[model samples]
Target: MALTTYSFKDLSGSMSHPTIGSYIFTGEGVGDISISMSTDRSAHDVASDGSIMVSKIAGNNGVVTITAQQTSPIHFWLLDWYNTLWNLPTSEWATTSMLLRNTSTGGSHVITGVSPQKVGDIPYQQQGQRITWALMAADIQHNSK
Candidate 1:
C-alpha cells in the first residue's frame, strides 16, 4: 500500500511587480486561494432542426483570488501595492506576475498581465477578518508536474 500526505503549507505563491519586487505567499495568515478561468473552453448552440454546434472559445483570461487575515504581513504588503499603484501615474502603471505552486504535487499556476480587479474589503470587529483580493490575468498557464 502507498500513502500520500498534503498540507496547506505546501501551497504557496508569489507576486512580482516592477515596483514592489516580489512578495511571497505562504500559508501564514492566509485563509484560502483560488484560480478560475474567466470562461469555459467551449460553447454550444442548438438549432431548431435538432442539430447542435459547438464553438471553441479563446479564453486565455483567468482570475486569482486570495484571502488573508488582516493581521498578516501579506495583507499589509498588498495594501501598499494597491495604494502605490493608485498613486502612480497611468504611464507608470504596469502589470504584475504571479506564480502559485504546490510543493507536494509539483503543480503550478502562472499568471501574467496581472492587475488588481478591485481593492480588498476592510472590516473591523472584535476578531480579525479575512480580506479577499481578486486579481485579473490576461494569460494563465497551468502545469501539473
Candidate 2:
C-alpha cells in the first residue's frame, strides 16, 4: 500500500482530533506531521554446548513517534494541554484514544496510553511563536490485520 503521511484535521480544522496518515494524532500545529511505530520487545537466550537457544522473546505494546508544529493561538492551546496533563501529581500517566486505519487495505487498531510532556523543555519558534513538539507515543496498537 502506498501509505503516505498526511495532515489530519477536523472539518473545521481544529487540532482537537487529527490523524497522521491513517493513524489518529492529537496535536496543535501546522507542519509536516509524521508518525512512526516501534514495537516493544524483549529477548532471552541460553548457551549450552556449542549452540545458543532462544529462551524467551516477546513483543509488548508499541510506541508511535509524533512530530508536529503549530502557530500562535493553537500553539498556546497545545502548550497548555501538554503542561497541564504532564505537570499533575499522578504517577501513572494517562492515555489518549488513538486509531490507525488503512482504508485501502482494510486494517485498523485502537491504541491507548499516550503520555503527556512535563519534564522536558518544549521548543518554541523565535519568529511567529510557532510551537513545534516531538511526541513519543507511550503505548500503541499493533494494527492487526
Candidate 3:
C-alpha cells in the first residue's frame, strides 16, 4: 500500500502588483486558497437526430480566491490594493499576478492578468470574520515536476 500526505505548510504562494508591490504568504493570516477555471475546456451539444458536436474552448481564464483573517496583515494588504485600484483610472489600472507552489507535491501554478472582483465584505460581530477576496485571472498555467 502507498500513502500520500499534504500539508498547508508545504504550500507557498505570493501575490504581486506593480502599484502595490508584493506579498509573500507564509501560511499565516490566510485561511484557504482556491483555484478554478472560469470556463470549461469543452462544450458539447447534442441534437434530437443523434448528432453530437463538441466545441473547444481556447480561453485559459481562471479565478483565485483567498480567505484571510481580519487581523491578518494579508487582509490589510489586499484592502490597500483594492482601494488603490478603485482610485485609479481604467487606463492606469495595473494587473496583478500570483505564483503558488506545493513543495511536497512538486506542483506549481502561475496566474497572470489578475484583477480583484470586489472588496471583501465586512461584518461586525463578537467573533472575527474571515474575508474572502476573489481575483480574476486571464491565464493560469499549472506545472508538475
Candidate 4:
C-alpha cells in the first residue's frame, strides 16, 4: 500500500452545501488515507471566521474535504479543501504541495502544507472582532482491504 497527495485551486462555496475539489492519484495499491486542512492562519482562526471542516472519505479513489468556514457573522462559506498525505503506513509516499487562492470579490482563506503531525495554529492578527478561535483536527482513514 502507498499514499499520494493531490490539490485543487480557487475553490468556493457556502456553509450548508459545499463544493468538491478533485485530484487523481495513480498507484499500484490503495492504503489507509487520512485527510486534514490548514489555512494561511490557524485552523481555529479559520473556524472563528465562520468556517467549518467536513471530511470526505473514500478508498482507492479521490478524497476532498470541505472547509465551510463562515465568511461573516451572518454568512458561511467554503474556502478550500485539502488531503492529508504524510501519515500513511507507507514510508515511500510523496508530498503534494498546494496553494489555494481567493476567487471571490470578498476575503477568502487559503490552505498550505501537507503534514498530519504538525499542529495547526493562528498566525495572523484578529480582524473585525476578537473572537475566540478554536482548533480541531478531523481525520478520516480508508483501508484498502
Q: Pick the candidate with the highest TM-score.
A: 3
| Cα lDDT for residue 8, candidate 3 | 84
Segments of candidate 2 deviating more than 4 angstroms: 1-48, 72-77, 87-92, 117-138
lDDT of 2 by residue, 88-116 (tens): 64543454445655544445555565554
Model 1's C-alpha root-mean-square deviation from the true structure amounts to 1.6
Model 2 residue 25 CA deviation (Å) reads: 5.1
Computed on alpha carbons, the lDDT of every model, listed in order, comes to 0.86, 0.45, 0.87, 0.28
Clashing pairs in 3: none
TM for every model, in the order presented, reads 0.91, 0.52, 0.93, 0.19
Error of 4 at 30 (Å): 24
Which lDDT value does model 1 have at 2?
93
Report the lDDT of model 3 for residue 121.
84
Summarize candidate 1's per-residue lDDT along 30-122 as a digit string, tens digits. Answer: 898888899799988999997989999887898988899999988898889988887877753547889889989889998898888889999
Q: What range of 10 consecutive residues in model 2 has the weakest lDDT sum?
A: 11-20
Candidate number that wins on lDDT, 3 or 4: 3
